[model samples]
Target: MLLNGRNAVVYGGGGSIGGAAARAFAREGARVFLAGRHPEPLQAVAEQIRSAGGLAETALLDALNQQAVNEHADDVASSAGSLDISLNVIQHGDVQGTPMSAMYLEDYLRPVSTAVQTTFITAQAAARHMMEQKSGVILAFGGSGTQEPGQYLGGLITAFEAIEAMRRQLAVELGPYGIRVVTLRSGGIPESLPSDMEGREEIAGAIQAATMLKRAATLEDVGNAAAFAASDMAASITAATINISAGALIDW
Candidate 1:
């Protein structure tokens, strides 16, 4: 019940991680607003939360639309008295598995561009509301990438880096207003995404073996972190980043 009576807006509430976070937030006593392009999935998550006697609602939206995002933020704040948390996990499918050299420039950078634009707009909309109330938490996601030559993960790495930077800057700018911006960076999550011909067990094992803890991050791990970030437990935590990659990071 860390988030009792709070109001939370989840931009990609239809996806696996987003849906998990939405449910977790609601379970903690927050009135959750699930927004996404897909109506059915968002509705399903809302229904589940409500069935559990939690406050949950669904909103059909294209997150990239700044005007719509702003309007939605206003509507939520109006209904809840004040917005407490905003998490953007919108999808931007511009990442093609091609390297910069051979990959068409258009396809190579599209995901980065789209993600930056949508996430920025959505965060800005929420920040404005949070600023008015002088309180809120903003959450975003990050990922890991292999550095092998020709491994080419498309532009996902670039996009994630940008997202991290944005979160840090937003944290600084919104700090005085009581809005905290942070990111939950993690390695591959297997609960929803299954492995392919490379072999599910092998790939998962390899990922675990590469991590310092000899294990991959779990959805529950992220959901818990997100809950804390949106709670008063993290009141003193802001302008910070938590790497939930199982120690799969090495800065050079």
Candidate 2:
């Protein structure tokens, strides 16, 4: 119940990571607002939460739409009395596994552009309410770090780095209002990959092998970390990246 009485808004709440975080938030006594472009998945997560006796709601939303994002934030704050947490987990449309030289410029830049746009819109919308209440937590997925040579991740790494930069800037600007901004960096989550994804086993193996613990982060790990990071127990933690990679990412 670390987040008791809090209100958390999660973009892309239908996705694996988002849904996990939403459930965790609700379990900790937060009223979770699941927002995404799809209704079915969002509703599925909401129903699960409600079945568990947790407060949950769903909204069909395009995180890319600034006006829509703003309106939604206003509505949530108006109804909930405060916006305590905001997390953007929207897909960035990244085309990985293709070498930059062979990739189209749009494909190379799509993730970078989409990541920044959706994050900015959602964070901005939440910030307005957070600033008013003088307290909030803006959570972001992904973080910048070393990548293996020839990984051919396209702009995925670049997109993550861009988000880290933005997170730092936001944390600095929003610090005065007691709003904390943090990013969760993971090596990889095998459960997040589709069962039929190409080279799925190899990819998961590589991810596990890269970590010192020989295990990639799990959806549950992410949920637990997210709940802690969003809670008052982490009030002193901000402008930082929480490494949940289990040694997959080594920081100096």
Candidate 3:
């Protein structure tokens, strides 16, 4: 049990990646608090964890609400005695892949603003609890978008770029407190394919083809990576972006 007595909080726990991380943490012996805007999926994940004999809790929370987010963190800290890990997998609901000549300025800007603020609020809440313990982990799952100029995903690219920058600064500020901040840059995982997109199989296959490993990233792959970061295994690492893109994002 790498996380044998740890406490983990996962925002956006209703989503595929977030749900996977929550389950992975619980399996590693960490008590997990799953929060998101919806109850059904979060509850489902929590139940699954609990059924497996792991400790779990669920909260229907809007990531943008600073008060609610902080209050939830406080409760988790109080119950668990310390906060070991905080992971934000919240979605920005941004319209991605819009050509530069096609997307409206406000549309591109909206997701950026939303993602930044939610991330800030969640991180701020987590920081307070972690700072008190002087030992914790902060993890964010964000694409390495800003690396390229605005392309098809102008909206999300900008948002993720800002997220990466903010995550780096957080690493610097929180390192002194013995709190590690880490980011995961992922390539497309099959679970995220939109229902509206026709030919899901073909799209998934193409994404895998584009990867250097000739296979796309899996939910378990991400879940395990996140669990590793939150575990004592990554004790010496902080403020780093662990790229799990299967060589998709490399410049070379």
Candidate 4:
């Protein structure tokens, strides 16, 4: 139980990555609060956790809504008595496979704006509580990385880079309060992609080929990494990006 008795709030907890992390957090003895726009998926994850003898709760709300996010954080802290961890994995609405030259302006900026807005709102809400406690972990996903030529990933990389910058700044500001901020950088997770996604095989293969380990990260790997990062064992880790890309991304 790495996170025994901890209370964690996971934005976008209904998604694949978020669900995985939530499950891991619950398994480690943390009472997980899954927040997302959809009720069904959130409830599904919650049910799974309960079935496995773990504690979990679901909240239906938009992560980008500042008021909603703030209220949710307040509610969680009030009920749980402490907010130990915060993780935001909301989708950025990125449009991939379109060259920048031909991409619409809104399409290119959607992810950037969405990522920043939702992350800022959620992190700020968590930071307020964390500062009061003088101890907490704020986790972020999608670390910056080099984009391959012809990849046409649109603004996905840009959005990630923006988040990395924010994470560093948050870490610096929150450090004095004993709040740790870290980003989990992954080359990609094969299982995260939809089974019927266009060019799914090629994309997964490219991801594997790009990784030094010849294997893309799995949902389980992300879950494990997130649990460790959010736990007290990682108290000394902050203002940093945990490389979970299996060599796909070289830090140095």
Candidate 5:
């Protein structure tokens, strides 16, 4: 019951990571508002949470739509009495597995722009409400790259670094209002891969072997980590990136 009586807004709540985190938030007592571009998948996650005896709701909207984001956030706050947690997990449409030298400029820059815009829009909407209440938690996700910058990640690493920088600045600005901004970094999760994806086994193996734990992080691990970070248990953790990569990111 870490989030009892709290309200959480999760953007991209229809996807694997977002759905998992939404369920975890509801399980721990937060009323979760799942917002994303697709209603079908969002409702699916909402059904799962409701079936588990938890409260959940869904809102279909593009994360890139600033006005829609602001309206939905306002509705949530007005209805629920507070906006306690905000997690932006939208897919940045990144094209990875390609070397930067040969990548298209659009491909290399898409994620950087999208990730920053969506994160800022959603976080700012939540921060406004959080500031009024004098407390809140803002969560973000990033690739965090390899130990020494290996190959094939393309603009994904840059996007993550940009997000990390934004998280630090947000923490500094929101600290006086009792709001915490944190980013979770992981090497990669095998469970999040599409079922019919090519080289699934090989990719999973590589990620597992790369990690010190000899296993890739799971959707459940990400969800649980998010719950902890959003809870008061991690009150002192802010303006920082929490490494859940199992040693995949050496500096962690």
Candidate 6:
């Protein structure tokens, strides 16, 4: 009941990670609003939450659309009386596995541009309402990727580092207003991989071997971390990035 009666908004709520967070928020007594481009998956997740006696609603939201995102935040605040938590897990269209040397210019720019745009749009929209309330949590995924030992990530790393930078700035600006901005970074969750993906087992094994725990973080782990961060228990945590990578990527 850490988030009892809280109003949480989750972007990309239909996806594995998003759905996990949304369910965790609801389980902790938050009324979750699931938003994404597609309604079928959104509805499916909502139904699951509802079946488990958790409050959930679905919305067709395009996080990249500034106007739509703003209106959605306004509506949620107005209807629920507050916007307690906001998390963005939308796909950044990152074309990974491609070497930068042979990668097209568009492929590299796609993730970088879209990640910054959607993140700013959703965070800004929620911050407006959160400022008025004088307290709220803005959660972001894909924490700082700059420290990761790799050159294979290409533009994906650039996007993650950019978001971490933005999270810091927002935390500084919103801190006085009692608003918290946090980022959750995972070294890569094994269960989050698509079932049809090729070499899935090999990739998952590599991820586990790289982690200090000898296991990749699970989708449930991300959800639990998110719920804790969004709750009052983590009130002292802000302007910080939480490492849920199971020591795969050291934070300091």
Residue-level lDDT tens digits of model 4 in 24-65: 999999999999999998999999999999999999989999
Candidate 3 Cα deviation (angstroms), residue 73: 0.8
Q: Kindly list the per-residue Cα lDDT of model 3 for residues 1-252, writing each as its tens digit.
A: 989999999999878899899999999999999999889999899998999999998988998999999999999999889888899888887765578689898888888998899989989998998898888999988757433343366678778888889988999998999999898877678777766776678767866766898878888989999999898888998878888888777745
| Candidate 2 per-residue C-alpha lDDT over 5-99 given as tens digits, one digit per residue, 9 for 90 to 100 | 99999999999999999999999999999999999999999999999999999999999999999999999999999999999998999987999
lDDT (tens digit, per residue) of candidate 1 on 1-252: 899989999999988889888988988999999999999999898998999999988889999888888999999988889888999887767544467778777776787888789879988988888898899899888744455454466887888877877877888899999888877877666664534534557556655766888778888887888898889998888877667778776444
Q: Assess each prediction's global lDDT (C-alpha) against the native.
A: 0.82, 0.95, 0.86, 0.95, 0.91, 0.92
The residue ranges of model 3 lying beyond 4 angstroms of the native Cα positions read 145-151, 196-199
Q: What would the TM-score be for candidate 2 when compared with the true structure? A: 0.99
Residue 162 displacement (Å), model 4: 0.5
Per-prediction TM-score: 0.91, 0.99, 0.93, 0.99, 0.97, 0.97
Shift of residue 89 alpha carbon in model 4, Å: 0.4
Model 1 misplaced regions, further than 4 Å? 143-150, 194-203, 250-252
In TM-score terms, candidate 3 sits at 0.93
Off by over 4 Å in 2: none
The predictions' CA RMSDs to the true structure, in order, are: 2.3, 0.7, 2.0, 0.7, 1.3, 1.4
Candidate 3 accuracy as lDDT: 0.86
lDDT (Cα) of model 6: 0.92
Q: For residues 1-252, could you state the per-residue lDDT of candidate 5 as single tens digits?
A: 999999999999999999999999999999999999888999999999999999999998899999999999999999999999999999999887778898999999999999999989999999999999999999999745653345477778889888888998899999999999998888888898888977788778888889887877899999999999999999899988778888777782
Check candidate 2 and list the clashing pairs: none
Model 3: clashing residue pairs? 97-152
Could you tell me which 10 consecutive residues in candidate 2 have the lowest summed lDDT? 144-153
Of candidates 2 and 1, the better by TM-score? 2
